[model samples]
Target: MQLTNKAGTPVQWQDYLKSGHRIFIGSNAAVPNALIDNLIENSAQLHDIETVHILTFSDNVWAKPEHKDLFKVNTLFIGGKNVREAVAEGRADYTPCFISEIPTLFKQNILPLDAALVMVSPPDEYGYCSLGVSVDVVASAVKSAKVVIAQVNPHMPCTNGHSFIHVNQIHAWLTAEQRLPEIPDQQIDPVSERIGQYAAMLVENGATIQIGIGKIPSAVLKYLMNHKDLGVHSEMISDGIIDLMKSGVINNRRKTFHKGKTVTTFCIGTQRLYDFVDKNQHVEFYPSEHVNSPVNIAKNDNMVSINSAIEVDLTGQVVSDSIGHQFYSGIGGQVDFVRGAWLSKGGKPVIVLPSTTKDGCISRIVPHITEGGGVVTSRGHVGYVVTEFGIANLIGKSIRERALELIRIAHPKFRDDLLQQVRKHYWVPTYQDNTPTSVPELGAVELKKFTLGGERFILRPLSPADERRLQEFFYSHTKETLMMRYNHHLTQMTRENSCQLVSVDQHKDLALCFTQRDHLGEIIQAVGRYYFIEASNSAEVAFVIRETQRSKGMATTLLLQMIKIAKKRKLSSLIACVRRDNAAMLKVFENAGFVRGYSEDFDEISLCLTLEETITNAKEIE
Candidate 1:
């Protein structure tokens, strides 16, 4: 074979190709279109030629049925729309492998490459040509191939980091000045935007995020505009990051690894995105082996891996690669980043998806993964699963707890069906009946966060999923505290009792809890509840605070919110029965405008508050 020092024609380079040669095409936006066209133009010159690549934005003519006899195509990840039908029809093959391990396949000769066709930027002053937008596994393929042909494109961005190769490394070269392919920005739908909002809440300031491309991920970036010192350590970066970088939100100033640099393996977006990374010192493109390695990714503290999934079961099993028996997409870097984030300090591994499919007829949160569906992320690996409804933290949860948490975030229409299925599987107790109730009033109540005595606490409507936590809260109180709240000595709280406490119908009555989150789960600090009395158009109210959390204004906050909710419900009056010796409880009710009421028992004091008259007085407590 003759190696050419100067630019050569495709026809001249085609002379060196042989039968049964495995050719690797550059992945993502850096595909060599001219060389791909050359192969299709001279298909008759080669038989049994194998082509391998990751994702390509070009027209996959080589994978079509017409070229089946001349060429065989294998894709590392099935993301391109044009190649799906061919893969499903067996005209093309899908190879499942983690993006981080693809380089090992080439270097170990497990998938030996006879030749590699790549596109690169023009050589710099030192004769080094950057791999440009896609370094990924292409760098390894070029190093392992027996012959390397390059399409030198002036349009390609000369990215930083380990994205360059010496010009002498190519066996032959040709110039192609065409613009790189672009993935048009997908329109963000309402469902995707809502999911993005919930996913963004899990990301903290000074956190490193690994987000992919799509409407949901793009929406997430939109919500992150106000976050401080965010960093990107992802397998791919798209147009979404450009705005965040410009806003100075993602300065990479606090990243534990590769501080002050945006690290990625590949890129696909509009021309503006390509131009943003061109010779940009802050953006560095590395090989997948280095960028997607779990160990390397965990080096960043507070790593939040936000990835999308096709479907998730009640058991927290995530299926992303396939739909039933059909292959939809590849495993990609989801598992790599999930585990990496899970291993990091203060990390959050989040899997986000819309509650239902695009049609809204089918629920993505199912009792079981579809038959023949592949589980890309197992139950043990799942952390936080977010949907439009809310976020479910699955880490350290039991099967029953996982089911309840997942059901809480599932589409409302499917919650009952999912509950029935979980019962059939015996994942939940037979007595468990905390399927979420849909009420218009429930939607109006937003999650509230408050700080008291220098500690942060969250106040929200008590959920049926909080049965276990409520029971734990019951045990956390001292005997004296329980007696004061219940007006009797209460020794034990059973699951049945705990379930009833959390399962109040919001339409008729109210139940709210003050909570603080720790590593184990959410801990209930205080609880306030009410039951309606239809005869007097009044409600019986109660309050309970943990022994250690009392006198910290938690009870006052819960009481104030309860009054607001009661007024919203149009209740005429509120009544409470407290032990005469419970001075603190009396003071809270008195401060909230409750007046003394007649009581038949001497050991207890009855208090009443007229909802319509106390509106002004309740504000004074705040």
Candidate 2:
């Protein structure tokens, strides 16, 4: 086939077509619609033509029943209604692979390409045509294909980074002026919105994010509008990120890799989004291998990977690509980004999905994955899973603890059923019926913000699974500190003791741990707890801070928060049995407005605060 000039006609790509050839198409919206249509219209002349792509939009004609035989559609990743039906009916083949390894498959001839059909923006002054929107594996395919045919669309945006192919590299070109297809915004329902809000709370300022494409991601991005210097390193992004970039919220200033560039493999969004990436120096598009590589993604500090799941089991196993034996979507980049983000400094790998699907008809959180569902992310790789109800941190948690934490975040309507299933399937003798199994009606534990010595701390409720972390926290403290907190000369801290301390009844006890991030991971700086005294309608609280973190006002802040919760729970009073020598604890109690009470022992002093009375007095003064 002869190459065409820059100002080529629309049908010039037809010259490259032949029978018994394998063609690789661009992914998502970047699929060359005109070339695809031409291939289908001329299917009468072609036989056994293999078509390869990932997640094409509605414009694909070969996916129809009539053209299925003409083109053997082999999809790397599956989506859209047509491909779903085709795959279910055995008309099309679905290949399951991690998005990060796709480039290597093409480069190594594992998926040899006879031709590459791609959509590109009009050539710039240097005759370089950009692979707008979807760079992904197309770059590798084009590089290795026998022939490269491009639909030179004027409507396609000229993107930056490793997304460009010189006009001279094309074997044939067709000038097409149609607008790129838009992925319309999903209707953000109250449930999705709430889920987004909860997920957004985990995202910190100056964090590099990898958000998947869809309504949940878009909804989550909406809540991050006010976040500062957020960098994006996603596999696919939509319209929501454009606003954040425009408003200077996502400046990519703090990203260690691609420091000032929003990196992605592909994009799917509206026309406005196309215009935003056009000649935009801030965005860099890379092939899926480089973009989704766990090692590459981990180079950026504070990376947050927010992905979705079809369903998740009680043991933190995520089923994303399939439902039972039915294939839904490809493995894609969920594992790649999940592990990458988890490996990154201050990274959080979050799986955000609605608690229920199909208008709350079914719980996305299930007892098991229906026997045949593929575990896209294994329990070990899973860290955080978020739903509209709340966030469940599953890392370093036992099976029983993970079940309880996950059930706490399930939809309220399904919580009881999930709890019943958990008891039936995963119950142990150590499980106490009197333990408050539910996460309380007040909602998920809010991440309380507190600053000490110019450093910030996140004070959140300690879950039963926090045993390992609490053990580390305990070991980090000196014997003097431990003795003061435990009121004994305890020399050793075991996992069993830590597990007991971290475990709490939501209704009758509160265990709040103050944590901050360091180079290693999240470190517990302090722990405060209050156990209910049924006889006195009060709670006895205790505090322990790492020696280095003491006198930093964390103890005082924790006491105040305990009092607030105590009042909300309708507890009349708060008490603390402080060692006589513990001047720091005594000062914190006094500063928190606690009154010294009568003590039976000489070595300890009793402190009590009338929480209900304090709340009443404050309201009256107000």
Which candidate comes out best when scored by TM-score?
Answer: 1
Candidate 1, 136-193: lDDT as tens digits: 8998998899888888889999999999999889878777787998887899988888
Predicted candidate 2 versus true structure: per-residue lDDT over 440-476, tens digit per residue: 5335435555677778777777766566688888778
Please list the C-alpha lDDT of all candidates, in the order they appear.
0.86, 0.81
lDDT of 1 at 212: 91
lDDT at 280, model 2: 86
Off by over 4 Å in 1: 1-11, 438-446, 613-622
At residue 566, candidate 2 shows an lDDT of 81
Task: Name the regions of candidate 2 deviating beyond 4 angstroms.
Answer: 1-15, 201-204, 342-348, 358-363, 389-445, 471-500, 518-521, 534-536, 579-581, 597-604, 615-622
Q: In model 2, state the lDDT of residue 296.
A: 95
Residue 468, candidate 1: C-alpha displacement in angstroms:
2.2
